[model samples]
Target: MAERSIQEVRAAQPSRDGDGVAIYRVAGMQHAAMDPVLMIDELRSEQREDFIGGFPPHPHRGMQTLTYMKHGGLIHEDNSGNRGEIRSGGAQWMSAGRGIIHSEMPTVDTRGLHGFQLWVNLPAADKMNEPDYRDIPAQEMVTLAAAAFDATVIAGNWTLDGESASGPLQTLAARAGVLDLQLQPGAAVTVEVAPGDSLLGYIYAGSMLHEQRELGPRQLLITSHGERWQLLAGAGGASLLLLRGEPLGEPVAQYGPFVMNTAAEIEQAIQDYQNGRFVPEARPLQ
Candidate 1:
């Protein structure tokens, strides 16, 4: 029943990734890692030049990624012979347990590509497990509609009026929760979060009042430990992404796409990639 206060507020930094796809990088702003969450990138743009190049093939290890698309489409291909398209209102969750080679490219000739890519860290114990993937379409996700607010549950459960909505991603190692929330003018919503959980929110449209502070677009809000928090939309209304997860509280060693527990493990990941041991053609999922 304690009130949640904002610990910090930071504006997203502009950056480019995946073949010049422009994005606003939030989280990981002040450190190499942020407990269970590593990075969050807001990729929303209407210009073709901002995302035409697309992301070529790449590798990842010891991490989980959740890609939620709101306005555009992305085609994903992995070395394990898995391929899919995450269209508007769809999502894709991929765990690069031990290692995985994959590529996510924007759908060509499409404008207004907008979405978010969130990176969640894997604990050391689950870092070497088998890689896995899950794709959830828009229709499959749970939605809660009300007169004052609308929300979509992406990776956890939300209950209102004795009805509950659950997301498809349930097996995350970090026990993370993801939600997309939209509030009409003067509307407010309270979200319950456990004490000691790392909670963060990114505002993409309009502004919201949280803990007596106003957060505007492109700003990231970090919350202190509390039982619950309340967010009230400004006059223009607001759309925000909410993320919460228990902290891993483990040492992290990261080098580019490789994340491990020690420097030696990071080196090993590099050597594996160089020697083709991590490639699909070399190992070939059995």
Candidate 2:
């Protein structure tokens, strides 16, 4: 197997989204070639604050969205009639397979709110599958403690609590892994990967030394995976999202709101939305 070393770190740029919410784009819509994991948009809001009020009713197809909140409350409603609220340390994992209309607006709160949204892409074979949702509370997240680092297993197969994280919004196992990690200052962790796999690290809080490179909040480190890569926290500890995935190795034809393998399919998706065939009717009042 080959070994990958940390290449370089790029600063995350700020972009605005729904209801004036600011999105510090970590990936997706910004860089190309990274698959399965698209973008990570962070949000914070307060009383009478309009910022990041949450995304209104929108349409998504062929992908999954993971909403993990650190603080505040979020109300989620979808055309499937599934509605719920997520608080701090909770996550709402929704799959927009085939098609789905959804809205995630924050409820009016006094103490404020903060959270991050991660976009994951479904493989071509599963793009037209059925849509679903998984609500995972903080307690449901299997937490593990290492000598210098702590990690929460989100999905796929990971040994935490002496077992693996085999649940919703998890590791697709098609050359992909996502983990939210918190490291104590001066602590380090090493992750192994396949030579053909790509490694992406996004710093959400604090700072870290990524293979001798300093990565701060909202910064991204793109590295090549050969043997393995190491991440060490700087002073004051650090929190990060570690992502690894095998290359799709296929042509990506994407436009506004839709991503597919070919241009013809992209056109078909657009036409379906325009013809009101992709979006379902709004839920009836109780």
Candidate 3:
């Protein structure tokens, strides 16, 4: 077991999306080696005005989205006949396989909105498969508690010190996993990751130390190849989202919510949506 070391580090930048909702762009298409992952957006604000507009109906194809909330929530409705709300500490996973129209509106509350929406690219072979959706309540996540940290597995499996826990949404592409970890002050832990897997840590609260580099909040850290990694908490403790998955090694062509393998495919997706053939009762795989 080798300790994973830093390969790259980028701080989140202020950005806007989905009808002017405030967000921090941490990672996206610009970064390569992030196979299976296309984008990550952090939505955090204490003011209602910053997020009131919400995301109106939009079409997505050839990818999956996972929305995890730390504060506030979202009311979700989609053309696939799925409707629900993911409250604070909850998560919603949707794979817009072929195509789907969906809207995620934020809940009005004093807590404001604080959460993340992640996009994962599907393999070319499965890009046109049937769409899948799931709304996981806060209590549904698997919790792993120890003296050093509290971990919630949201979409995959996690094992620490011979103990294991799995989240409710398990059928992720390329074996990707999402974990929310909170470390106590001066605490430390060694996490196991498979070799060649893409491992990233997004610090949202406090700070953390990795191989002598003290990473602050809003910093996205990408780690190099290794079978394990050690996380040491900073003075006031640390909180972060851990993303791990194997590289897809497939070509990706993306155009704002639509991801495919070629430019022609993207064009086809656009035409399909415009022609009202996006979410029919059933469509044969291409």
Candidate 4:
């Protein structure tokens, strides 16, 4: 496969929230036509001047959101009566099947917080299942490293180590790959995907030349088939998230936060929320 041109490299826009820390959003990095793995939004907050508050209770349907903490703490409460507080190294995987409502707030430590919240869209079949959440403490995650790159398999398969998060919420199918990778300087990595699948790379730290284009922090690289992309880290090294998924060939009638096959279905989702038939109050975190 020849090198594909770098599609685009754009920084995540900063979105400040009620919480003090700044939040960067990398929403729908891929074009709507590709139906690529959608990262609806991301948040990074650190304790320094003040705490980073989070989105108040909100609703979600037909998607999954994964939250991993690197530092500080996050307290989560849901209308389902569920409450969970995650500290450094902890993770939360929530699947808003048919629908659910929840809130995530920062703690008052003033130490700041750093983490990533990745949203994955559910396929047509699983879109209406009962919503669920899996809280994984940092200690429960698997960490593996190669000479050039080290990675944590948070939700999907790891071909080399064969270890992954075995919990209630997982990567889902032959359709998804969610990996957090850290590469040393001068290192390069290559990934292969099933034909017609969606592939994307997002730089979180440092920079790299990808698909013949220079990609710095916060930029995403989306690729098509017949292309073998190589990522080279800068002298300071780099960190990023690698995502791939099978394309859902069905028509995508997306409206705001909900994605369905038809506009009428999207309308139903909105009406469900308005009628309060969609809120799945949280269950107390055990």
Task: State which candidate has the highest lDDT.
Answer: 3
Question: TM-score of model 2 relative to the true fold?
Answer: 0.86
TM-scores for the candidates: 0.93, 0.86, 0.95, 0.82
Error of 2 at 100 (Å): 0.9
Better of 3 and 4 by TM-score: 3
- Report the poorest 10 consecutive residues by lDDT, candidate 3: 277-286
lDDT of 1 by residue, 1-286 (tens): 7877777787999999989999998757224224688888999888989998877888899999999999889988777677888888999988998889888888875788989999899989999887888888988888888887888889976543344677777866688888898989988777777777888889999998865667799998888888777778888999999888888888888898888889999999998877777644633432
Candidate 3 per-residue C-alpha lDDT over 154-179 given as tens digits, one digit per residue, 9 for 90 to 100: 98877765678888888778888999
The TM-score obtained by model 4 is 0.82
Q: In model 2, where do residues sit more than 4 Å from their true spots?
A: 29-33, 45-52, 158-168, 171-175, 279-286
Per-residue error for 148 in candidate 3, Å, reads 0.6
lDDT of 4 by residue, 4-73 (tens): 3345554678766543447777666235523545563455544455444466666777877777777777
Cα deviation of 67, candidate 2, in Å: 1.4
Judged by whole-model lDDT over C-alpha atoms, candidate 1 comes out at: 0.83
- Model 4 local distance difference test score: 0.67
Residue-level lDDT of model 2, residues 83-108, one tens digit each, is 98888878888887777777888876
Ranking the candidates on lDDT from highest down gives 3, 1, 2, 4
Worst 10 residues of 1 by lDDT: 277-286
Cα displacement (angstroms), candidate 1, residue 283, comes to 8.3
What lDDT, from 0 to 1, does candidate 3 have? Answer: 0.86
